[model samples]
Target: MTSDTTRTEPVASPTDRLRRLVARTEVVLWDFDGPICRLFSGHPAPGVAGGLVDWLETRGLRGLLTEAERHTADPQVVLRAVDRAGLGRGVAAELEERLTQEELRATATAMPTAWADPLIRTWTALGVRLAVASNNSPRVIGAYLAGRGLADCFGPHIYGRDAALHRLKPDPYHLHRALNALTAAPAAALLIGDSPVDHEAARRAGVTFLGYARNARKARLLADAGARDVIGSLEPLLRVVRERGPGSAPRPQQHLPHH
Candidate 1:
């Protein structure tokens, strides 16, 4: 399904350009972490990472990692390091389960993005197909979506982290899985994500990418990675969809709030 998705619109405003991109998209592949909610807002990620490291120490595997790997705040990095150390299936599975539990706990306080809830609903009503492709576990994504009353919008199209950490993005395995499930051509899909890894995965999968930069730093990161389009806020996209047509759109308001 890999194909070029270059836009042909001439001299359009940024918003108009975005509309054109959206207009061509048939499948919306969303990343679980950023576009939808801040999953680690309440349950800090660093704390969870530390907890994982502690779990390793208790098992007498503390010497397996260098001081830096042991102290790294990214659990994925730690998990991968463990695998490289030949810790085997048992350790990997145990780490994954522990991380899943932590993620489940985090879901209770996951903060939805500013316009994500309503915008997701609006897209659903517009007959646009939606799916989540994330590095997080599918179970956690399902739980969070169900809790927010957004499960029905995506149904069973949630592709998440596999037991093999090596297969995660920017490997494009999960993205390919999502596209395959939807029977979608990559050119006809748009992935809205917040990281360069997401952009790289989308590019490798030949899917159009819409970068969601919640702050200037993220915007710069995406740009540096050669992202053609990145937005600081989803407000403009929400406005376009909300003004698309009768009944399919939400009512226009005096101001579209920023997140």
Candidate 2:
């Protein structure tokens, strides 16, 4: 299904982007990283939405994170563990703290190509609840949001590690957690993200996937994998939610809102 999804004259606009995105479904189950947040690792780092990821892997590091941590994947929990691991290489505990401080001073965590705040606001305004299903440490996710002043964008529904030790994305555990949290269901929900990993995770979990074209090649791969929809912008996806109406998408993944 990884074919290029080409649609000329997108029936979407900046002002009505959220409205259009909301048309296709209800709750918007979103991915982090290239979709909502941007990583601000320095120098050799290619920066968010660029080849920073490739840069990291090229450095023998999966990311600013450690090995066991990269395997963790879910930003919601991985960083939290890494923060405590003090066990990994690359970033010494002291150095991690120092760099994290530096990152906080500059990056706002939102992708230049994304408008996470409005997307959330529109969904909420449409009476649609939002939930996070990431593969990182809750602490890091929390810190990233707070540091960027985006902690309120998702309210308290952020699910991270410490919540589910062995349950992460592509395993469908986070999906289950989101359902429980939002009281949502898989069939009725839609997940939007920018990578094959996100596509695989949603497919394995049984939720509809909307491959955001953050990476053209990855987007093609996701479409080939059977994502229900694909788009380069959040506007169209929001439109999709509105079309789906209330209770039409997957339910929340877990219970309780963190912080």
Whole-model lDDT per candidate: 0.85, 0.56
Score candidate 2 by TM-score against the native: 0.58
Query: Over the stretch 47-165, how does candidate 2's per-residue lDDT look in tens digits?
Result: 32123223335655455555554544233333344345443444334333433443444354334446665666656655667677765445556667676556776677776434333
Candidate 2 Cα deviation (angstroms), residue 143: 3.2
> Could you give the C-alpha RMSD of every candidate to the true structure, in order shown?
9.2, 9.7
lDDT of 1: 0.85
